[model samples]
Target: MSLDLGRTASPGSTPRAPGRLGVPVTAAEALRYLTDLGLWIDARRSQLSAIDQAALNAPDQGDREALTHDLTVSMALWKAIADRYELLKVAFDSGRVGPTQAEQISTLIWGRLDVTPGQAGEAARSRVPSTADGALAVSLPEACRLSDAMTSSLRARLALEPTAMDVGLRVKSIREGIERIRDQIGLIPPGASRDKANHDLVGLEQRLFGVTERAKRGADVGGYLGPLEVDVAGRERDLIVAAARRVSGERDAATARAKVADLAARGDAIRSLQAQCLRDVTPAPKLGVPDVRALGAVPTDADAVDAFLRRLELVSRALDQAHETYARALAEREELRGLLGALDAQAATSPAITEDERADLAPLHTQLVATLASTPVPLVRARALMAAYQSYLQAVTTNVRGPR
Candidate 1:
């Protein structure tokens, strides 16, 4: 929405009076279209997911090729929808604006169609999400808002230029360094080896730097990968790296809490064993020992209740200490729950896993589900938490993409 002061139209360009959307070609209208696309893509994804689940869960006797083909077609449609958004997202990021809303629309449309032949070929291979029932939907009602936005962008006639990739590469390289730093933070006697991690990190950074440099120079760039690379390195002073750190911290916290809980349970079992040992070692109370309550029956006024008071003080203190430990254990469990939320929030900022990448995480996600299902929490809440976390990351990543 920030107006570019440098926009200039060539000679003989017709200046436009504001159109129906209040700007030239309605960018707001364009955005609305994108929103619509998101809705359909999401719905399609959900439908696809259900199909995958059903197929995988059933006896292994389905038409695999046929199913794959059907899903492939669905993926194509989804790519078309996503491409529409990616184009707008790029232009907006590059600060390209036209003199009127119509021009803005024209630029966006042209940009989509203007890909280098090689880029187009690569795009053709990018799969779409497979689905049709619309179980997963993109938020659509708000998509119609592009009309004004396109118009406003056109009014500015902002300049369009290819991004300089060196900066991005340099920034990405630093992230590798930061990752090593993060590993160092935990690599102590009680932790992992930071030096070994750092050694591996150097190689990792070098590879990342080399690849990024190539991408900057127009090598190995293709489809959604280009935009995704931009997202990792193009944002503010590499806040993306900061985000990754948050994710790591969340993961560590969650793991630590889990470990603590396991240790505490073990300690409780051992403590119980120790208590039994003490009982056995006491040799059943000797006949000379006070008969706890029977001492009250003594006829000589020997302050019976006083004898009981001293023993009660010791028992009460011991119970109080145990209660404190139990309370701490409970609090730690709650903290772990909160850490899951934090981790989810951080993961949400991660670039979305494509259908292909989703396959990789499928195992981990499935494991998470099975583990969560066995917990006291309801399946609904566990499932909801993961979905919500995914949605949150998608939104945050989208925002980082910026509007032209």
Candidate 2:
């Protein structure tokens, strides 16, 4: 609900341009499709952190490990993002198509507005259309905000993470929210306060997500470096008090202004006093707090919650860094696994593949490399998984496709 829906002007929002067959969208239109991406990500990051904190608090090792998965790279983050875009494209491309459903699905890759609507459907989602002057149509989802499609794709490859349907549902919910907005736009007036009301606030975050840089500097809260989340509860109360003041004429207005000034001054003093008190209060010893440096001991029992989270954080941070290495490894591993799966499927269904690196081309080598370069990792789970999987793939296909 606290989504800071940025105020970026909608780009290339030429109301459904003339695409080949499906939605005729420009590259920039995609940028306007979502908003507050950072806030959404921050929320997810918070969820992950909370999960780690919970695991730390759990009594049993197995329970702790179960909760620990929550601290890992979100299983759905990538796929959810991609699928939302996919659904967005689908809703837009609903009427667009060649002669078959397969052809329509191919258009999912994007780029084909100039293909002369006639030929657009013909090419279908087949050969990705190269724009004039020759360029790839759109860069696949690469930003953070862990999407469902990417994670689903990631899981299918690794076979290590949970394969819950909730992940899929979570993504569908987001896209549905977006689609609902587009559906309702024709009914609502733009810029009305109401336009911003009654929404998940997540959809609006896409506004500046892909186009601008977002950092959680404004949203993130640190224990040692920050006060308890600004309490904003008090700020809200003060604002209400400020708003509730009665002012009829000039004199009443003046009186209200003076009261507000006094309240502000008092609030500032209160904050200063509170800070001073915090600085002076002696923290009770938690095994080592009082004798921290003197006894060469530190707070080891950071409570169960804090201790578990610290471990999760350590592991998560390491995994977040190694995602690229892991992702590339995952892609390669998926390809190998797919190849093997297809070989088995074909071996059962028909004769062997002839004249091909792969034995079964029944699905016919779509061979698209969708790079989830921005995928997130709870590092703890992903690091060991990727290392082990990558090592296994290397042992099997050492001479295969080089690191994607």
Per-candidate count of clashing residue pairs (backbone under 3 Å) = 39, 30
TM-score per candidate, in order? 0.21, 0.18
Give one digit per residue, the lDDT tens place, for model 2 in 213-256. 22234432122111111111112222221221111122233433
Candidate 2 shows a clash count of: 30
Clashes of 1: 39
Supply candidate 1's per-residue lDDT for 106. Answer: 45
What TM-score would you give candidate 2 relative to the actual structure? 0.18
**Candidate 1 lowest-lDDT run of ten:** 128-137
Write model 1 residue lDDT over 16-131, tens digit each, in one string: 21233224445554544444444544544454555545444444354444344433433443454456556555544433445554565544443222111122222222221111
lDDT of 1 at 283: 21
Best by lDDT: 1
